[model samples]
Target: MSGEPLPPVKRVVIVGGGTAGWMTAAALSRLTDAGVAVTLIESEEIGTVGVGEATIPSLLDFNRYLGIDEDAFMAATGATFKLGIEFVDWADRGDRYLHPFGIHGRDVHGVKFHQIWLRQSRLAGRMGQVGNVSDYCLANQAAASGRFTRPVPDPAAVLSSFSYAFHFDASLYARFLRGLAEEAGVQRIEGKIVHVDIASDDGCIRAVELADGRRAEGELFIDCSGFRSLLLGDALGVPFTSWQHWLPCDRAVAVPSASTSAPLPYTRATADSAGWRWRIPLQHRVGNGHVYASAFIDDDEATAKILDNLDAPPLDAPRPLRFTAGVRERLWERNCIAIGLAGGFLEPLESTSIHLIQSGITRLMSLFPDTGPAIAERKEYNRLLRQEYEQVRDFVILHYHRTNRTDSDFWNYCRTMAIPTTLEDKIALWRAKGRIIRDQGGLFSDDSWIAVLMGQGLIPQSHDPLADALPIEEAGRFLDHLRDVIARTAAAMPRHIDFIASHCRSDLAA
Candidate 1:
């Protein structure tokens, strides 16, 4: 009897090596049995788009799934915990809001917190606008105060019950995953894939032909070839759907700058004339990028805009990247599956790039076939991947479309332009009823849309009628009490810089 555990995926080939490639390999290696053979091929000449330094709370699950040591990973990557993102000047100008990780506040008398706040705002002589939604969220408060503390194990402290993620060096993270993938019996091939050989009978990719005349054959092929898309797009011929109309910022200029005095525990995205600039603080340096549409701004100006907006002195030359913002019509073609830039390029506004890659790898693992790739399996993979990408794309578009900024041509287009009907319907419903169209497939929660909608000055026409069931004075008192409690709790926490220094600081930060 064969000792092997039934040979689930005997051979697997990964044709890329950046964060996406390595992350997929590392994850699949950990999840599958010993009989599986995973191979990753890449060229030293190729470069990775590694500006994705900031992340959301979903990373907690991915890290735990990878069995990564949190402190070690943070220290190695020069990670700073991110509670949420602060959007600057997005509504009109000089306006801001933080899109936090968790819920706003505890519901009272079985009523939604925002509805209660809305009810209070209607009361005569109410001083506060009650629109500062982040106050009730511990993570958002922690971010605003420039403080960080792991939720204490005690259940009573609301601070201990909150969530967070990391802002770190993307390159360092790739190296970390590479090490794990290699240790788990993944064969790392160092060469450029010059060609993909195909089988005559099935037309599936038979093997990847490297520049050095080496052929890497596998029963199933994964194209992680970044924008080159060597196997799935170039060889198998899958069409890509361009979403430039919906997500128009097709160019990006990224630069890393020396750290500000001490790194903060959150990422900042400030709206600009052409597009927006992202500021991600790591231990030793800050990652900066200006994403814009080339139609409105030239390369020289965009580069200058990015350089002028840096938090510190430039540490390296600015690198520019151009991409058509969209996903492939088919993520998996024949026996080959495309991941990362090969799959599609959605802007990293919410840092969904890595998360999408992780999800793709996981879905593949779940649908792992004993034989060659099946159409049913491929179809399901594409369905989930399309939904995930579209959902994130729509959410990112909301930030731009709902804005009141008509200062620049770019902003004017974003503000007045027609958007996806799905998004329009969601916004229209919220404006009338203060109710979010909850969808499980949607990446953002009701709290998220509420933050952006309210931040962009989209208040509901009227408060939730159900909230009227409570006495007017009682509703006002509850709202005031929650706000006070949140403020007091946040005031008692340590500074974010101090929290990192005490718990997660490594040689990188030191």
Candidate 2:
């Protein structure tokens, strides 16, 4: 290694201009104290795939990091609160479950709360007084009752265990972030990139030549070019590893519908014959989509199904999207780093798309390199990003693979398909006992795993042995008390619509 210190990254060029690009620019511009000049280029003619509207709780961290006010952001995006996702008809035809944003209940006697819940549930089943698992979860109960409230900061409070995200208009969110980015001294260039000029000697990107004969040059390039993967895939020639065999639902038809009633404090995902449909309620309208495998059902049929399922008339014609589920072999290659859809795509089964984007941006910020490329830094960034992608991939796969619905070929394939060894091990452990292996870097926590596993009828054969330390009757009483507390707390909360009106309701005229 050279003894001389490397120069800090002076100029960064971000290609594309949707959520990914703007989020990257806004984050770098605000977070970097070294005064790295950031420039983002995009053409209004090139429309973005703004379908990832529903988000997870981690989005709060992203917003907080950027110093965005919650109420203002919600109003600007026409957002509604999201407590969790309700999976309808997933495990069985009539079965439904809510995967809440928080844990089931507080741990008892140093054992996981879910373990105690399992033990109590088994006992209750024997006594013929089994209760719904969701009853013990504050977020689940609140979502079920169309209630909304900010979580209490004190962990001792019954409502403190829960968290929330948002359902918003993706296009509006991009606009909001763009304003933030531009205000933070980030330059915005409006143009379509005609060509990327590569330095012949080092094979690094030199500049991007726009259609208007203007060349924007930079030392580092961030690719947020959506599925086209402009700089990373086309210019850098990074190979994409397609996971179509595992996640075969490669097409989606999305549309906005008029809101028929007060927006619920959660998202709804109803399983269909060939795939699934999502309903995300926003303040102004509802976002709806059907994600389906083309091999199992044609686009026309999927579109028809989605249209027929809409709660109200569609605001516009259904827009179709095509994608292969997988990530690039390397998210960071040479001097270029790919974020968002350009990096890879896993279907939004659990509303993880935006979170993945946030994770990538955060990781890139953490491993931000100097003006001179560092091979080691690039390798580390790629490794972390790959891990993130794989972890999310496995979690999403669990939803599909751990199913008993064989009414259609798609469902049958998903039910019988082989899964990644990581997921296989996880399933095996859960089946053997109510244990969740925590991944240090994974997005979903143990509580999330437990919720999905139990929701999808993948109940463990027995509770964790540690849970047996407590008497069976004691555990049952504890669960009953917890469920009652959650129910009463949720019942006393303000209605979701009323909460929005009181705090973050949007003035469309503004």
Query: Clash number for every model?
Result: 5, 0
Candidate 1 lDDT over residue span 1-510, tens digit each:
223233234688999988889888898785347577889998888767666788877778788988999988988899988888889999989999888876788767777878777767767677475646676777777778888777766666676647788898988999998988888878899998888898676677778888889999887888888887888788988888999987899999999999866777778898888888999998888999998999889999999999998877899999999888998899988788888889998888877787788778878888876755576888888899898888888888989998888899999888888998888888888888688877766778888888888888898888788888988777666766777887788888888888778777879755
- Each prediction's RMSD to truth: 3.2, 1.9
List model 2 lDDT by residue over 230-345, tens digit each. Answer: 99999989999999889999999999999889999999999999999999999999999999999999999999999999999999999999999999999988788999999999
Q: List the candidates' TM-scores in order.
A: 0.95, 0.97
> Candidate 1: which stretches are off by over 4 Å?
1-8, 31-34, 127-131, 152-157
Residue 107's lDDT in candidate 1: 66
TM-score quality measure for candidate 1: 0.95
The pairs that clash in candidate 2 are none
The TM-score measured for candidate 2 stands at 0.97
Best by lDDT: 2
Candidate 1 has its poorest 10 consecutive residues by lDDT at 1-10
> What stretches of model 2 exceed 4 Å from their correct place?
1-8, 31-33, 124-126
